[model samples]
Structures are given as structure tokens and as C-alpha cells.
Target chain A: QQQVKQSPQSLIVQKGGIPIINCAYENTAFDYFPWYQQFPGKGPALLIAIRPDVSEKKEGRFTISFNKSAKQFSLHIMDSQPGDSATYFCAARRYRDDKIIFGKGTRLHILP
Target chain B: DAGITQSPRYKITETGRQVTLMCHQTWSHSYMFWYRQDLGHGLRLIYYSAAADITDKGEVPDGYVVSRSKTENFPLTLESATRSQTSVYFCASSGYFGDKDRWYGYTFGSGTRLTVV
Candidate 1:
């Protein structure tokens, strides 16, 4: 079973538009959520992360909106640019478990 | 050069042949993990080790073997390579997080592209 589920296997957006990628999880024990960005032929890198306590967290143009009750979270890219085109993955981890559960991932393409 | 490194950025092996992927970290992290990324399937954990000589199976571990005899090295071996096993494999390391309040994300290597023909 997939612990974390992501929607929209792929996404396309115009430059300066906002691209939102969403993920949902069933495990209530999950306390940490993070998003990773990967370019072609490269490993995924940490983009941003959020804790369940806060409703949202932002870093530069990337933001994470988390809803603890709904067990859903989403990643939003503000002023999306062509450079933001990459595969985005949402991941979650429990307090006790060190391993992270990754979503299926969403491939975002920003058109200039 | 100071972060985690994976050997053989690309490899091609015949079916039924044995292949091994090497991962080494200079930070001497206490935790190490192996993951395979496939199209539409995303990233699936193959195996992980919390410390030297302590290993555990992840979501997918069949036909795959891993060993952590040292703190900085973790190797994954496929006894008999299969077409279904062809994918990009990633190695990640993280420090021991005794504090649940603090979140330290994983450091991933460039990844190895393994192709079984």
C-alpha cells in the first residue's frame, strides 16, 4: 500500500503562474512532511518541509500548506519560472520511524 | 567530495547476471538507505540500516541484498538481475535524530542508473 498518495502525475503551467501539487496520507502518526525536487538524471534534493503543528511554511518561492486533520498537504510555487520545471515529490515520516514514505511524484513543467 | 557518493553512475548488465551498487558517505552518518525510482511508481525504499551491522527491509526488498559492515559504506547487490529491476537507484544518509522536534532531511547521492538487458 502506498503510504503517501499524490495527485496529477504531471502538471504544466505558464511562467509567472502558480503550480500546486498535492499529497495525502492516511497515517496519523506522521508528523513531518517534506517536498523534494529532482532534475533529469539527478537525485532528489530537499526543497522545503513543514511540521504538522504549523498550518504552513514558506521558503522563497516555495511554500508548503499542511492540514493535519485532513491528512493532506500541498506544495505551491509562487511566480513559477521555467527553472522550476522538475519532478516534485512529497514525503512524510513518523516520529518513531526514521524512514520516509514518498508519494508517486508530480512532474511539473513551466512554459515560458 | 565530502558528501555521499555512488559508484558507476551508469551500468548495463545482462539478465541473470549479478550486479552490485556501491554507496559511500564521508559524514559517517548513522543511518543509510537504498531506494529505487521508477516511472509512475516513484521512489520505493529497498533497504536501510540504522547503524553498522544493523539493517532492515523496506517497502521493496525482494531479489535485493544490502550490507552495512561499516559506518560510511553500504552496498546493495542483486543476485540475479532482472528487467524489472532496471531503474535509478539512490543512496541517502542522515544523522541520528534523537530529537523528534528537529527535522533533518536526508542527503541523497547523485544516483546510479542500472539497466538490465
Candidate 2:
């Protein structure tokens, strides 16, 4: 079964605009939620993460808004730039579990 | 220099041949994992090791084998390459769960693109 589900397989937005990607997971045991950014020909890198205890987290222009009751989380890119265009992945993990489950992905494009 | 690395960034193998992808890390992290990325399926774990001499299967482990002989090395071998095996492979390492402060998240190697013909 798909433990995590993501929407908007692809997205496009103008520079300086805000682009959001959403994800929902089924497992309440998940305590860690992280977002990863991947440029073509490169591996995905951790962008930002949030714990279930908090409702939101922000790092630079990236923010993660999480709703524990809804089992949903979303990543928002503020004042996005063309440099931000890439594929993004949302992942979840249990506190002590060694494995991380990843969502399919969203390919984002920031138009210059 | 202190990061995970994957060798042979690209490879092409004939069907039914044996191919192996190598992964190494300098941080000596206790957990290492292998994942395959497909166009629509995202990253699916194939195998993982919590430490040397310990390994376990992930979502997809058929026709593939993995061995972790030392703390730094985890190699994934395809016993018989098939067209379905063509995909990008990634290796990642992380500190144990107890080190939450140090576990910003997994540190991933670039990736290895494999093609089976």
C-alpha cells in the first residue's frame, strides 16, 4: 500500500510567486516529515523537515506546514526563483525506524 | 571527502549478466540503504543494513542481492540483469535514530544510472 500520497505530479509558477506541494500519509506512527529537492542528474537533497509536534517549519524561502489531525503536510516556496525549479519529494519516518517512505514526487518549474 | 559516494555513475549491461553497484561512506554511519528511482514510482528501497554483517530487504528485492561486509561498504548486486532492472540507483547513509540531533536526514550519494539491454 502507498503509505504516502502526493498531488500535482508537476507544477509551474512565475518567479517571485509562491508554489505549494501537498502530501498526505496514512500512518500516525510517523513522527518525522522531510522535503527533498532534486536537480536533474543529481540526487535528492534534504531541503527542510518538520516534526509532528509542530505545525510549521521554515528555512530561508522554504516552509513546511503540517496538520497532524489531517495527516497532511505541505511545502511552500516563498518568492521562488528559476533556480528553485526541480523535482521535490516528501518523506515520512517513524522515530526509531531505519526506513523512510517517500512520495512519488512533484516536478516544479519556476518561470523566469 | 566526508560523504557517501557511489561508483560508476553510469553503466550498461547485457540482459542476464551480473552487475553490481558499489556504495561507500566516510562518516561510518551505522545505517546504509539502497533505493531505486523510477519515473512514476518515486524512490523505493531495495535493501538496507543497520551495521556490518546485517542486511534486510526492502519493498523490492527480487533478483537482487546486497552485502555489507564492513561499516563503510554496502554493495548491491543484480544476479541476472533484466530490462526491468534499468533505473537510477541511490545509496544513502544516516546516523542511528538515537542521534536525532545529528540526523538532519539521510545524506545521499549522487546516483548511479543503470541500463539493461
Candidate 3:
């Protein structure tokens, strides 16, 4: 079973435009939400993360809008750049399981 | 900072061959983990160790082996490599924390691309 499901296997967005990736989780116990950006031949790095207590958290041009009631969260990259083109992964963690469960993945491309 | 790192960066082996991937962390963190990343299987935990001798299997632990003899090194070995075992292996570590409670985030290694031909 895919505990965390992400939509749109891939996406194409123009540079300077906002690109949004959505993720949902079935387990309500999951309180931690984190998004990671992965470049080819590299490991995934934590981009932004938020606890369920806050509805939204923003850092520079990256923002994570979370909905506790909906058990959903989304990452929005403002002023997307060509360098931002990479595979994005959404992860969720619950108290029961210490390991992070990741969504399939979403490959986003920023067009020049 | 020289954090966690995996050796060989890349390796190619044939079926029935035994291969071991080495993971080293300079931070001396007590918690270390091994994960295999596949196309559809995002990141499945293979095994984890809390301390030098405490080890446990993870979500996907079949056809794999792990050990944490020292606090900084966690090695994973495949008894007999199989085609299905070919994947990018990543090693991650977190500062020791209480069970089921909040723990420090993980620091991941670059990764090792392994191929079983």
C-alpha cells in the first residue's frame, strides 16, 4: 500500500513561474512532513519541513503549505529556475514508525 | 564538512557474486541506517543499528546483511547478488534519540550505484 501518494509523475514549468507538487498521507498519526530535492547522481537533500502545528512555513522562495485537517501538504517553489529542475520527493513520518515513508516521486523540469 | 560517505561510489558485479558496500560517518552518531532506492520503491530501509552492537531489520531486509561493529561504520553485504538487488544504495545516520520520539534529522551519503549483471 502506498501510504503517501504523490500526483503527476512529472511536470514541466517555465522559469520564474511557480511549480507546485502535492502529496497526501493516509496515516493521521504522521506529524512530520518534509520535502527533498534530488539531483541526478546525488542524494536527496532536505529542502523544507514543517510540523502539523503550523499551517504554513516559508523560507526564502520556498514555501510549504500544510493542511492538518486534510492530511495533505504541498511545496511551492517561487521564481523557479532552470537549476531547480530535479526530482522532488515528499516524505511522511509517524510516531509508530521512525523511518520516513516517501512518495513515489515527481520529476519537475524548469524550462528556460 | 566530511559527513557520511559511501565507498566505491559505483560498483558492478555479476549474479551469485558477493559484494559489500561500506558506509562511514565522521560524526560518531549512534544511529545508522541502510536503505535501497529503486525507481518505484522510494527509499526502503534495509537495516538499522542503534549502537555498536544493537541492530534491527527494517521494512525490506531480505537478501541483505548489515553490521555495526563500530559506531561510525555500517556495512551492508549481499550474500549472493541477484538482478533484483541492483539499485542505488544510500546510507544515513541520525543522532541517538529516545524510542518513537522526535530525533534529529538524517544526513545521507552521496550513494553507491550497484549493478548486478
Best by DockQ: 1
Mark the regions of model 3 whose C-alpha exceeds 4 Å error after superposition. Answer: B96-104
Query: Chain A alone, TM-score for each of the models?
Result: 0.98, 0.97, 0.96
Clashes of each: 0, 0, 0
lDDT of 3 by residue, A57-96 (tens): 9998899999988888999999999999999989886654
CAPRI grade, predicted model 3: medium
Lowest-sum lDDT 10-residue window in model 1 chain A: A92-101
DockQ of each: 0.85, 0.84, 0.58
lDDT of 1: 0.93
- Candidate 3 has a DockQ of 0.58
Chain B TM-score against the true chain B, each candidate: 0.94, 0.95, 0.91
The fnat scores of all predictions, in order, read: 0.77, 0.77, 0.58
Which of candidates 1 and 3 is the stronger one according to lDDT?
Answer: 1
Tens-digit per-residue lDDT, B2-112, candidate 1: 999998899999999999999999987888999999998999999999899999999999999999999999999999999999999999997745665665788899999
- Angstrom error at residue A57, model 2: 0.7
> What TM-score does prediction 3 earn?
0.92
lDDT of 3 at A68: 86
In Å, residue A22's CA in model 2 sits off its true spot by 0.2
lDDT of 1 at A78: 99
